[model samples]
Target chain A: MPRLRATAIIPLLLLAASAGCSAPGANDDDAKSGSGPIKIALVDAQSGQLSSLGAWELKGARLAVDEWNAAGGVNGRQIQLDVFDDQGDPTTGTTLARKIDSEGHIAMIGTAESAVTIAMAPILKQAEIPNITSGQSPGLVAAGSEFLFLNGPTSTTYDETLAKYIVDKQGLKSIAMITNNGSYGKGEHDAFLKALSSRNVVPVADQVVTTDQKDFSAVLTGIRQKNPQVIFVGAEEVESGLIVKQARDLGITVPFAGAAPQGTPVFLDTAGAKNAEKTIVSSPYLSNDVSDASKKFAAAYKAKYNEDAELHGAKAYDGTQILLTALKSSNVATGKALADAIRGTKYQGLLGDFAYDQTGVGIFATSIGTIQNGKLVAVTG
Target chain B: MQVFLQTIIGGVSLGAVYALVALGFSLVYRTMGLVNFAHGNVVTVGAYLASTFYLTSKLPFALAMVIAIAVTGAIGLVIERVLRPLENRDFDLMLIGTIGFGIVLDALVIAIWGATGRAVPSPVQTEPIDLLGLRIRTYDLVVLAIAAAATVLLVLFLSRTKRGAAMQAVAMDHEAATAVGIHVGRSNAIAFMIGAGLAALAGGLVGPLLYVSPALGGALGIKGFAAAILGGFGSIPGAIVGGLAIGVLDSFTAGHFQGYSELVTFIVFTVIIMVRPTGVFGERTVNRA
Candidate 1:
């Protein structure tokens, strides 16, 4: 009886394993013919702490894909956009990269966390799978994978522009900085510090914090002693909000400045409106009402998601649109040919003009904005 | 001097929250000989419950806290009852079971609350008060006062109440307490309820100061365990002292050293544990006489 059971189970196990390994475009014939629906994997943290990024990315990507599909989808072949949750973890991202590669996804979008994107870059490069990411970390560029593309400007560009405004134009010489130890934070820290040094100004206090730290009293207290004109925050939305709120509680009324994360809804909501007021932000996509095209996109986004569009969603939408445009123009090419097509195609996006350089950084400029009355408005000349 | 006072005040207030969580760790370990890793999730549950009640249902903040605490205590009873069958088994089995239970609670928190962080409204005026030329948040002072009142009440109850003494007896010897006409299971249940109640109070109090999110538990849980270990496991006063020490060290290190705050704090804990294996106030013997 035991021998007979083993014989039956062995064949069943083999069949299941084979089925599990099978994927949509895994066949060589399918890859060459460019037949069937085009598969593009959307990787982001669909659950856990960074799920907000994933949710926004999903909505933006879905909106673009749905629009394309409705309009006959790049020469009559529907684009199949599949979602994969990375849990904001690098290890999970690597696993998802391998899965997407084997599953015959021609291109990929997101893995919003910079660390996860950097970790998956090599794997995607080896698989010849071109990916567009929403991560703004300079480390993504440092990864030096031609297959990896960014949807927005790096922290370097953002901080440089911010420094030019705050130092050269406004002349806020005395500054204090509080940053976390995460990949995004490190990039902002280095870029902003370099930008500050270029102007021959040194921060009065530079406090480094852990990424997951909730309390900012100790660090804020230390900064209070210095009494800087402004505090440069090199952290994400929630952390930056906490820092601003705590700084206010400590009676340090200096305005806080940061990159993309500071302008987000999460940051504004976390820090009460009164506390978040006058916060300076540097980003390519300042608001959804920047232009006529932006106004149209924002209307559509709100119509679909029933929520106002933000930087992450705007970037994702722009990235997805760029990817689809390249796919259409290249006649739905794959691998190196598709990558060349993406690089070759130039188009105006919601954020800015899309033009990829050698380092996969498409955009190179960010306008300065400030939070006023609970809304981020661009600083008009 | 002003900065020094501010740091100490900030540390002590944060420490008060840790002390509340540490008390839960001490209570469960004493009566059940189980660390009850799910205590952190209980904290998260309480925060979310209070937030939901206050923000969604438009209940008064104080009333929301009361409902949250009561519900959390009931959850404690349920958890203890569910684990009753595994109580007599190997200690590791119960430890692993509690960890698994914690994961389930964490997942439930996400499913119900959604994985986003919500700002809980502060019951007290969020503005800082001028005290001795130092700026201190009014909410921090309230947190410290509540913790002190809770500690005093806990000490008084353990010394003067029948149920509390029964819990202590059970902690000393399960079989002996069972033979002495004390209902061992009842005593254990009471311990868990009280412990969970304290955790809920901590969560509600700290919720406004920090973002109430699913990951709040994991971040606070490690610090609570460290406070428990530093205080010598089962000692109440020791937990408070340990928590304050850890908070002060964390604040001071971050203030002065900046980059090495966590490293310095953990190193101090490691060195203290290595030098004194039984913790500051831990009993020298395996079983209390």
Candidate 2:
């Protein structure tokens, strides 16, 4: 009886080992992966200062993937997601994009960071893998990559209009801008400056800091001396928060206006809710008082993730929905076909309608908003 | 004038953090004759460990800080022992090994505490205070006080305590100190433990002002090395002076230059190295090269 049990155990162990050895080969057939389940790669700042935004964006992607898989995946194939941490570094982002390209993933939905996404676009384009991102830089679409799609508004696409609104409508002048030294940072900085110049408004100071910087005292001190009416911070949520907090701490109570820097909850957390108050931000998505579609998306997302959805997450969800629609519309389309389908299609999403034009730049519903009582509330331009 | 004073205060606060990190580097270098590239990441780990524990357990800030420092000290002990395996390895390779460990530690921070930056709520009220007609954050005062007190205690221990003298003796000549009945390996372990605790304390002190993030590891580590070099490689008083000097100069430069400030800081560092190869107060050159 003991000999019979040993023989049975040996055969079971052999079977398990054999199964493990065969599984990876069956799963990693990249060329055939597109024909089977659609693969979507996410390479973002998943583990750094910017990780909060990345986490929410990925959460949105996860929701979209789950919803699609539940309702039957695109063309009866399951959606497979491969995620990597770019650490908010462009080199790391490019490396991950190359890996994704080599793996032959059908498409990628990622890189909420404008600089990282900009770095990734060329690599994904060369590999002919369609990329849908949520970064708010005009350069993301303006680069004219056939493979790149943005669910968020481009920095310069309506930047001039936003700048005009601030100058003409808000009746504020003597603006100073602080920006991160990344691709998106330079793009938005130049756009704002150009727009301000077009309106014959010149900035008091234009300061640049690297992305890893946390201290803003020196820069803020310099800016405070200028005594600008509004300080425009052209950075993301966390840095914006730190800047706002530090500025206030140094007794510089001038209100801050920015291109989406004050829109996220992170701004409140980092800067303290009181410090972030009255800071105006331009955003493509509103956290509250939105359409029924947005309401449903926010509700579903909250129930699923147990957190309030930010703008990047909404954009990621919409981008993934767009990707799913494109996937379902064509059975044998290549990555270029997928890109073309997206550029041509008019997609309604939780954020708003997205319709990419010749430049692959899409217009989304946008608004200027302010932090009121620790929440982002839309204000009329 | 107010801006100038505020800049000084800001520099002092930042420099205090640098001094703490530098002090650790100097200690590890003195005891083990190793660069201990892992020193900075230990500060990052200590911060995350403390804040995560506080966030989860709702422990008092003081108690959480103690446990966190203790844990990092234990980790330091283990690390020193583990590096023993590379006893005969080339110093450069061992240096790389320490850096490799630091990278792994940083990665572990992301894996456990996660990638998002967390705010270590201040134990004291964070309202800005008026000091000598200058507006300063209360947290800045706490940071300066803690850093100064730590420096004082370190000085007192080295000058007054038997164990501290023994460690200093080991630092002076390990073989001679061993022959004189000082336990060299034990002193080395103690040196590491103290160095790690100081780093964690620095992390805790400054974490509220600069939110705790994994990037904190790399940022402060390089700056600490600069401070260590500026103060004289193995000098305690030099670390404080060098750190403050670097911090103040950096702040003033940034206040004026804005964008070019970081570039200016590095230039100054290079200039200092060129002018004073032995550093401001570095007594021994220890020319291994």
* Top-TM-score candidate index: 1
Could you tell me the lDDT of residue A295 within candidate 2? 83
User: Model 2, stretches more than 4 Å misplaced?
Assistant: A1-35, B85-93, B131-133, B285-289
User: Whose lDDT is greatest here?
Assistant: 1
Just chain B of model 1: what TM-score?
A: 0.96
> What would the DockQ be for model 1?
0.44
- Where does candidate 2 chain B have its weakest 10-residue lDDT segment? B280-289
Predictions' DockQ, in order: 0.44, 0.40
List TM-score per model, in order: 0.94, 0.92
DockQ score of candidate 2? 0.40
Q: What is the per-residue lDDT of model 1 for residues B1-289, given as tens digits with 9 covering 90 to 100?
A: 7777778877887788998999888878877777989999999998888888988999998899899999999989988888877777777887887888899888788777777668865777646987765778888888888899999998888778988888877888889988989998888788889888988898888888888887787767788889988988888887888888887777777777666678888999999989987688887353332
lDDT of each: 0.85, 0.78
Provide the interface RMSD of candidate 1 in angstroms, 1 decimal place.
7.0
Instruction: Give the clashing residue pairs of candidate 2, or none.
Output: A138-A155
